[model samples]
Target: MNRPSILWKLYIAAFYVFLFAPLLVVAIFAFNASPFPSPPWKGFTLEWFIGNGSVFGKPGVLMDPIWLTTIGNSFKIALPVALLAVIIGTVNAWVLERAEFRGKTLLAMMMLWPLVIPGVVLGISILAFFSRTANGLEDVLNTDIDSLRPGLPLVILGQLSFILTIATLIIAARLRKFDRSLEEAALDLGASRTRVLRTVTLPFLQPALIGAGLVALLMSFENFNTTLMLVGSDPPLPITMYGQMREGATPAINAVSLMLMLGVGGIASIFALTSKAQQ
Candidate 1:
């Protein structure tokens, strides 16, 4: 085996440091004994991890319902979005891979449009269209419709616009590399299309589906810009965290962040191990 050059080693070290430095800081502060969440560490304490008060008293208190509800809302939005994205994206991937159609490139570009467009712009557009549509419905029916205001549905819609694209790309990449001979053999053996898909094609796509689902869930959970504009009264975790940060963040925020990071990391690690074992 060839040893890595000094420059290559330095670059790798720098990249690792860059990625982990912020996380290390957050983890450290989550246990900081100081009343203040920042520098000048007073001592070591785990009170913040248990949802204790910070230097800011009421504002710094952890494990508040507001934070919990925000997390719940995030999960509520993420679960549905991930499921829908996977379904739609899987179908899209299958179609694009198996069928040769006109406007294929254009359609592919359209699917990916959300990634290029700024999140704020997408949020505004969806909000405007929904608002206008809701108003028109109200005007035509002559009925009040307050439920359409920014909420879970709006958040889901906003996130789906982009997450679906991610799912499509992931599944499509897998499809492109798939061996069609197996599917053809199944068909030659008189298996129905649905049966072939369920038994053969789907098994191959499982890993990609799992990965896409995770990505979609994470994207929806951490989304802030679109959620802020489209989420009416109820805010997701990221929005709540942003608000807290704006209002002089408490150590509780760090605690919550630490918990989230750990949770996500644990889930991802488990998935990785499971996938490796299956392989």
Candidate 2:
């Protein structure tokens, strides 16, 4: 391999710095002994990890119920959304890729609409539509629909609307490269469609399926705007952090950010190592 040109080397260095500099700063501050987040690092301390009932006037350290609940809520939403997106998206991809139908291009374009729509707009639209539907249902049934409130379920629905499209696109792209003859051969050999799919197609699609689900989960977890508009009372971690930041910036917030960064980074590292080992 040829050595990188000076310009390319400079660009790579700049890109890495840009990507990691803020994270490095945040991690540094998470351990800084100074009360203020900005610093002149007084010294290193772990009190930021565990402090009095609050961090710089924001609820508390990571131990706060709100923070814990927010994290739980995020996972609750993300997990279901990932599962549902994979199911729906996989079906959609299969149909589009296997079935020869009219208006296929149009259908493909329509599938991409969610990706193109702004998150805030999508959230508001979903909230308005669900609100009206829920009110109508309540009027008809004379019962309340508590599950529709700003919580895990609503957040999942909001995220799935867009994230599912992404999953579909990924799976569909993979489907385009698949050999259909294998399924036909399996069916000719007495295997049912379900059996063929379960034994053959699914295994082939596993990598794409996993990738898409991970993408959907990450998108759902990090989502804020749609979650903000659709979520009623309880806020997810990002929203909770936003509220804390607005109220007052604190080292605890920084600490929480650092923890989150490390958690995600660690998961990514483990995945990479495992994947390499498998290879």
Candidate 3:
């Protein structure tokens, strides 16, 4: 068993090739000089990433104001979603892991609902519920309820609804493995509950919290189905990319994808290093 059978070796090789070949192609095509990313590759250029948008020049992802604005909107939405989701997740993890209450098993099962629901269905439900609630409130109360209308706020809420579930699961998994004796020891020495939590509990949760926040941020950034239902006048980067792809395929999309892959990969690497150091 020291060596894999020929069939197993072939399967393993195919698996890796299948996994990475498309990404490698995308990286290569990002620099393709052709306006489109199809076959018959032209020389090479960075215009898709940094062009000046002259009469003959392509307005790269960086040069396009619309793309930049959409990118900004994505960050605007993702940051808040990540932070708030993490906070909610931490609270959920604490309650679910440390405290017990009536219907705990049912509540725990309910927390997994989001993980199984289809994203588009979830988006539509949230949109419809909020829209009707807003209408009802405006009609009865005779006041504007702008926040309940479709917009970034609603997008954040929709994303948060599902993302917090993921975050909660992650944090709770970590909290489950935590040694309670540390907190008990600190408390036995007359440490306040808040102090013990702040000093001991939170420190132990650093890795899980960081992982959850990163997942939330990335998920929010690339989210499409839910975002599509809830987007307002402003669109996020993924929505903008969809619009562009609908118009025509271009090397610019590849360039943007390559950049995202590099950026996210770098952030993940750093996070891994930091977590290792903390350990």
Give candidate 1's error at residue 216 in angstroms. 0.5
- The root-mean-square deviation over C-alpha atoms between each candidate and the true structure, in angstroms, is 3.1, 3.2, 1.9
Top-lDDT candidate index: 3
Better by TM-score, candidate 3 or 2: 3
Question: Please, what are the lDDT tens digits per residue for candidate 2 over residues 108-204?
Answer: 8898899889999999898888888889999999987977655667778898889989999888888887888998999999999899999989987
**Deviation (Å) of 221 in candidate 1:** 1.3
How well does candidate 1 match the true structure in TM-score terms? 0.87
Say which candidate scores most in TM-score.
3
User: Which is better, 1 or 3, measured by TM-score?
Assistant: 3
Q: Estimate each model's TM-score.
A: 0.87, 0.87, 0.93
**Per-residue lDDT tens digits of candidate 3, residues 1-279?**
998899999999999999999999999999888878887888888888888666235688899887788888999999999999889999999889989799998999999999888999999999999999999999999998988887899999999989999999988988998999999999999999999989999998988888889888989998999999999988998888899789986788898889889978976886677557545
lDDT of 3 at 262: 91
C-alpha lDDT of all candidate models, in order: 0.83, 0.81, 0.88
lDDT computed for candidate 2: 0.81
Best to worst by lDDT, what's the order? Answer: 3, 1, 2
**Candidate 1 residue pairs in backbone clash:** 150-232
